[model samples]
Target chain A: MPSDALPDDPLPSWHDGRTKRAILDFIARVTKQGGPDYAPPAERIAVFDNDGTLWAEKPVYFQAQFALDEIARKAKENPALARQEPYRSVLAKDLKALTADNHKGLLQTLAVTHANMTTEEFASRVQDWLKTARHPVTKRPYTEMVYQPQLELLALLGKTGFRTFIVSGGGVEFMRVFADKVYGVPPERVVGSSDVVTFRMGKDGKPELYKTAKVEFVDDGPGKPVGINRFIGRRPILAFGNSDGDLQMLQYVTGGAGPRLGLLVHHTDGAREWAYDRKSPVGKLDKALDEAGARGWTVVDMKQDWKEVFPPAP
Target chain B: MPSDALPDDPLPSWHDGRTKRAILDFIARVTKQGGPDYAPPAERIAVFDNDGTLWAEKPVYFQAQFALDEIARKAKENPALARQEPYRSVLAKDLKALTADNHKGLLQTLAVTHANMTTEEFASRVQDWLKTARHPVTKRPYTEMVYQPQLELLALLGKTGFRTFIVSGGGVEFMRVFADKVYGVPPERVVGSSDVVTFRMGKDGKPELYKTAKVEFVDDGPGKPVGINRFIGRRPILAFGNSDGDLQMLQYVTGGAGPRLGLLVHHTDGAREWAYDRKSPVGKLDKALDEAGARGWTVVDMKQDWKEVFPPAP
Candidate 1:
């Protein structure tokens, strides 16, 4: 039967053929009346892993970079901080020395730099920094370097009665400040990690929560699925991710009854964007690669799939 | 000059007195052109305490009552819970026995009944219970018992371009599930206490978070102010509360520069509602009495000020 609905917009040179077709086909089937995978608008849920899935996450996760910078900035002003091991390493910009201590150093950096400010104040600082911060590799504003393919996917899904969500490992509060503007996903729809924030009366006589160093929740890998169920309360029929950190999420999404889709973005376009997998220090895509074929998951080869990696740098 | 925009519904009995007038007047001035307190619609923020301020917290908080009942129910089915101190007392329905253990019993009960469920499962359970549960005292659905005065006040504020937010010590997740339907406040605008939830792939092959027993954050008293600043960023020009739990919130709101209003709902209507102060175990209004007077906060005397209490029970 000829359909009355307009055809979805074609992905230009930006989106890889395989990835773009898989996404558009999924959306088309989900929205088409009487189609095998068709779902009503209420049930048309799509979730994407952030970090490497939506944007670049190397040489380090953006948030970790923020913490490293903050630790260095704070340590320069306080001699006590410079005396500390991880802080001292961060202050020296010795990335090699900092990683030698393993994840413990990362945790320490997060604890020291991300805590004790009013939530409003922290949000404001993040907003100010994001406004001017450029990606070290791309040299484009970090936000502008967001993947063009992913951006198109989000908008395309939205047009197909899909309610998209960013199921991320990044701080929920941090992403919340700009997600709506950047992704068109409202704050309430973005689920991620969070720290404890206690409400207090400020000098200005307004109620606010000061962000604490205390870890409230960590949303990553298995934690991603947990956060989705907790905050969203519905199983997404479609899920997209990059790296092993998203394996559990894909497993959960594709395991559902009836029609489901899971896609893994494989980094293989070093010419257009930095590419690495398996042994890479950040966004390692290993176990997921081994299981993709067996699990019937579509794997997107970045070099073949995405013609344009990122939007033109301003 | 007479206002042309006044509501024609004939103000509810709840808003026929001085307390209501103060709120309406503040709303009117803040929204009217050339008015001293006038603010643009985007900046018209108003925050309210949830428990006693929006709904009844009398006898005990609704969530506390739910926690206690859940413990008792579980204890009846499990031998292990019967061995625990607080659960042992709670299972016996011995309010006297439970009170003897104080906050310890309450915390233990909460830890058991509120944790371990998938976030989706928990939200569904809450939604189901809300549909059927009735207030112990009022014998009406808990949702129906929400303060009519506050409802009118919310509407009045909305008419004046203010965005109302619920800042409470209750679970933000719990309130979020129903706030939009009941109070016209969206989920994102509701801030409250929470526990850590970890995402995982469930047996059903979907991402879900298991609620943890550990406290993530406590949104009470001082926490209210902190939550406001963290979640809203902007300072509210008006605030309202019912007990000492809200003292910090009121302080924060009133402390802001320019025109601000703070009000406390004093339980003085023994005929229409329960009346108790300072010495009361629940919703204690002690420290806030002197603070309110000192800071020029409007204290609402329920019996004398409110001509009505609840809406016709649903």
Candidate 2:
């Protein structure tokens, strides 16, 4: 089918190519009447991994950067934080040195910086920060760095009776604040990592939020499938991802019976977007490459498939 | 509106006169365009408290009852629980004896009985128990004791485009198992109490669930509003409850600017269902009573409201 035949919305920007055709074909077949793959609107469940899949995840994860910045800000206020390695490293702007000691320091920084605030306060703070925060590498607002193709895909799926969800490794509380505005996926449908929070009486004797230094759940990789099962209770008929972090989620979705589609957003365009796959520490996509071919999953080559990358780069 | 006007469904056989009218009236107004307070279907968001609002809570919370039974069953095999107060009380069939101690013992029992199992195992166990477990007072299966009026309310709301959510204090995992079958509300829409759970590799090398003792979040009383705000984000225009635990939730919903409705289910028929309130230890309905009258919240007097209770009492 020609790209012109498709709705003149996001699909027009998809670039007439194999990857785009594969996705459009899958959606059309499933939604068409009398088609063997046709599923009722109620059963059109589609889940997407947020970080690298929908938005760019370069320099560092947006949440991790937030934690590091928060730690530094807190350390400046309290001299006691200088005594702490991770906090001190964060304060010194030495991400490499801080992470060199391994993930323990990172975890400690996350715990200290993320905890003790009420869930509401934390969410409001995240909302405030995201409004002003800019991605270091791209020099654009972090929200603006979101992939245009994926945004179009989300809208297309929604138009086709699919209820889309963001199942990511990012903090659920963090993504929930802006998901509705950016992705049209409501907070209820966005599931991700979370920390335990307590509802308690504030100083004024009104209910207030208090965060506990406990990991509630981490929705990533294998945890993604588990989170989906626990939270959604229904197997998604369609799934999308960009990294090894989403491999298990994609596998779980495509493994299910009935017409299912799994698509991987391969960052193959070096010019349009920073493209690093197998050797990249952040979004390593090696294992997924072998598995995608074996499982007949659609691998979206960003250079060949996407006509536009990040909302016309404006 | 006459009870005779209701369809020949089994629901009318259970709702009391006042409860029936409040439900029918709400439905009528929401569906009718020229009614005194008409609302479009999308604006209709109805939240129900699971324990007392949907099923039997007397004798003890159904989840608490399951925990105690599991504790006793484990104690019989392990013999270590004989030293524990609540487990010992549970073994002795003296649930009243544990009430003096409050929630600590109950928490301990829950941790031991509910944790360390795969999510599938826990869900299956809940489903199995729901199938066979009978309410001690009613001698009817716990599932059968569910309010037929509320079930009808759920169906009626669904028919009119209102999405019904089970907002309760019971474990979210526990409710997710049977909510779709019992309430017609899918698990994704069901918001309730939750504990931290982890995903691990199962024996077959597939991802499996492991429940943790850490309490993630509680969806009760004030927590109800927090959960609704965090999950749904949209303020519900309609709210229903039977106890003081629901007061804050109702306040949050009614505080919204647009057309709002709040209904308090008053158990005033001792013959059909337990009628004690205000002074009752379980589901206390005191402060809410004063607020309901002041706020113009609809209060359903079970004795005067409905012509029937408990779906034919079969």
Candidate 3:
């Protein structure tokens, strides 16, 4: 009876709508005593896609912005990169040219800007960046760009004994620096795209793990399910995403042999947040949006469903 | 002061010895308040090497045995494999011939037997194997061969709020099924060697993940530290291992910023368990054993320090 007792509207930031009602109804059904849909505490797993689902992903991905910043800083050290194809395009801030290359340009930019340092060095650099980096449009700290409604939803899920994870297309180490503070998720619970790392002993007799230029996993679209299987080892009962990059992840979550919930956070508020769908270069939601209705997934229109965004602009 | 309280000889299966005392002392120092070595619950990360360290790994690895069993089962379906070099050697149960071609023979065997199946299929096969398979030398179920002392140690660490993880050279999925029941570690905490996995769509339009034989990581020797850093994201304060395969992990744990405990379990009890070190082809303990004394790692001599080996003849 206590489990069935509806606590106060936990999603206060979410306007009373069909989307909000769907989330509460599912959680209640899954947590109710001796219910057919009840999942055990450990099995109450919820996974979320980070970029567009939890935070703003345009005008470009925050990670791409980080890569751009790193390139500018390192350009002073590696002048040869300034003359290269991708780097030349990157340094010139040529977004159209970079986008025309089919991820070749982005991959090259990341390989140059993200590799060759020890993991500790990389983590420290990310931490330092988080302290100073601001969103280009909002002029707010990147961490402050997280959705307030999603934060409320996350807390509600956690209160109902769900173990949350961030399965993202962004860099794993980069998200780890702020996942705890921004999302209440720990580093080990964050799975994302990762480059290869080589382990070696330092000349000073200590172990050193250095990041290399090799791309190990992409963790987008179909790769999302692969990353989930590799890291979490269990199919999530609930999955939240905003774009086509999370299509397979939602499919995987909702396909399990139990009651499942899949949600798509539709960025439809142009005033509160940037609104672009289907045609956007970054965090495009076309295919998944077309597929969502057939899949029985809840699609939350940001303007209609959410009363506030971005933690009330800090 | 309550945090300093010891739980009535947590390792009762472990005999009273210097190695046992070292474990108790390290735990006490780390859990004690204001003693300089005190670690918070979040920082109390402990990593254990599976296979030879957690369970019995003799006559060959348990995973290798699984691969061999798979080879025989699939041999009837693909007789061409039976005519192949590694398959021929494997079907003949010729270890020497299998080892002669460096790792080429075994890798090819894995590639054939381990590829193209859904992860669920592989997991089901492993579960079926576990139910019926017996160790070549011990004639006991492989699960029964887990060390009682190590199990007690794991419980003790858990009681002290230390989060335990399995970093093994075996397949991550293989260890996951039994790790929860046997070691009380959940699937996500079990980090191990993982091959590439592909995501696909089922006929029902649901996502399906399949295992591939392209070995993404080896998770042995140097790979241990890399796996730890990649999965855990924090340096473990305590590390336990059994062979040279675990040497780098011990080094990584001990090389952290604070006081750490590194342990090596020496397989010296031939009467209770298989005992082969230094010159042994499998789970060799030569270089690590030689370096343990200088490295200040506690080396537990199984013959001398363990009062009981397996779980009280369950």
Candidate 4:
């Protein structure tokens, strides 16, 4: 079948709604060769913000949870270390105290958890974490908490020759571990916040890239377009996100010449999933929400637009 | 046809010799299903350095020549600018004087030419330049000077399920302008030195990323492995290069825990192409040459390993 031809009910989980219609129409127009809005396969680039857009980001980001877990594991291994500032606070379950002073303690927790390991070792740890870690609220494996509609959308885009990429504020190495299996996006296609890594000959005489404590690049807010330009080297025609962090990415994608889409997956299903936005500390959606409305960008009300949330437990 | 199956004389321009044989053998081993060395398509990555490996890099590195030409063009547009230090030297054709003070003038030439422009505008300029720029010696269009044998090899690798990428010390945007058309590698797959880009809303209300003067990253020597890690995310199973700039990349690729091949293109054809290695100012192949020999990596003697150099003129 031609790539432009859609499979029957491709996004079955998405309900018949304005947002869904907009997405389908945009895909159809872009894929229709010789049409005025036609974009060639190379130009059919679509970027999706990971955390709250593709999966649940409630309680906290999955990556942050992973870091906290890593800290706990380390503290368990070395008991005396738990008596330290961040570790003591973490062990005492004092979230307020740990995040005080501009989240200094939390930043320290992230630093120790995220850096000072070989790239290979870091990847292995991420893989191992994903294998067993469960979402705090959902109690499902973090990967399993991914939205069914978003997964279907990703598949549909892939089938239509759109190179779907995860442009997230999440750690690139963390997301890369499961991006392929969960979203069908390869590691190279996953652009995110990253730490500076130095290359050196390991003790084993093999080349090893050690992740340093310094932040190299951050794919958040204004950094999104910069990251896209540096990594993808293409301005995506379609961009999807759930927060103010993705505002620049959506604007960058849609601002380019030709037909484009800028979508926001507004979390509005409090019962089915977390629905806090704007006021929510995690995945805040305020300025972007206003901009989306002003610009006629699709704003997906999670409860109204989606017939289903997470897929059935495997 | 299955990706593992090779066409008749897939690398037609490659002469039947040790380098070619090694390349073919490595590809076969990596592609053969159920074989111990077989790597899945996702794992079958091949990275090639641009300047001296895929194309000629003398009488000077092509990118440097491009910078010089850009400087001349700017000087021509604004005749008053010709009186300036770098511009004065460039306009007078005194390359030695311009590069006398630790390459201060040459660096300035690159800075003015390569940065402070929108990425779109920069891309357009590069496109315009490549359309007309000719090598000083051969006088052929720059893109047309790419090696036919290497081109054939890239095609062969793609056919054999390898995702080919260009990892160059050249500017990322500059290489990306011609990489797709000249080497079959996409823009995103081209990793190289880059200037930091700032994202902002343009006066036209569209998002624009402006290239800054500061060097964000340099993809040479040790920087090569870091570039590979950041951009490709996978340890390439096959790596090819022609200079010491690619030494760490070759080491990083071959050092991975897998069946791998690190190949170097030695400029041994002074008759067909300029041959000045080890002591050559441009694309010096001293340390990498020694390392390649010691590691038993395949080293292509350009005169012996290929039947053709550049493709026929259009």
The CA lDDT of each predicted structure is: 0.77, 0.78, 0.87, 0.89
Question: Second chain of candidate 4: TM-score?
Answer: 0.96
Quality of candidate 4's docking, in CAPRI categories? high
A best-first ranking of the candidates according to their TM-score comes to 4, 3, 1, 2
Candidate 3 residue lDDT tens string, A1-314: 24444456788898997888899889989988699988988899999999989988888888878889888767767887688777788889897887775877877778776898888888887888888988888899989999999998888888888999999998887888889889999888899989888889888888889899888888899999999998889899999999999999999999898899999988888998988889888878998999899989999999999988889654
Candidate 1 vs 3: which has more DockQ = 3
Residue A7's lDDT in candidate 2:
71
The CAPRI classification for model 3 reads as medium
i-RMSD values for every candidate model: 4.4, 3.4, 0.9, 0.7
Clashing pairs in 4: none
Tens digits of per-residue lDDT for model 2 on B1-314?
23354565434544445556556666777667877677765567888888767776786788877786677667787798687766786687665675556656666678777777876688888887777777888888777778777777778677666888888888888888888877898878888887777766668755555778888777888889878865665567788888999988888777666677798888887887878789988888999988998887898776666565566555
DockQ (C-alpha based) per candidate is 0.31, 0.29, 0.77, 0.84
Model 3 chain B scores worst on lDDT over the 10 consecutive residues at B1-10
Cα-based TM-score, every candidate: 0.78, 0.77, 0.93, 0.97
Model 2 interface DockQ: 0.29
Would you list the rank order by lDDT, best first?
4, 3, 2, 1
Residue B266, candidate 3: how far off, in angstroms?
A: 0.5
Clashes of each: 18, 7, 0, 0
Q: Write the per-residue lDDT of candidate 1 for residues B1-314, one digit (tens) a residue.
A: 13556556424756466766776677667777787877877668899998888888888888877776667666777878687877777866767765565567667677777888876667776787788777888888778878887888887777667788888989877887788889988655687888887756568655556888888668887877766655565678898998898998888788877788999989888888889889888889999988987898999888877777888854
Q: TM-score for candidate 2, please give it.
A: 0.77
lDDT of 4 by residue, A1-314 (tens): 26446667889999997888899899889887889999999998999999999989878888888988988888989988988978888878888997789988888888788898998899998988888888877788999999999999999998888899899999988888899999999989999999999999999888899998899999999999999999989899999999999999988888888998999999999889978888999999999999997777999999999999999999
DockQ of 4: 0.84
Evaluate fnat for each of the predicted models and list the values in order: 0.48, 0.33, 0.76, 0.78
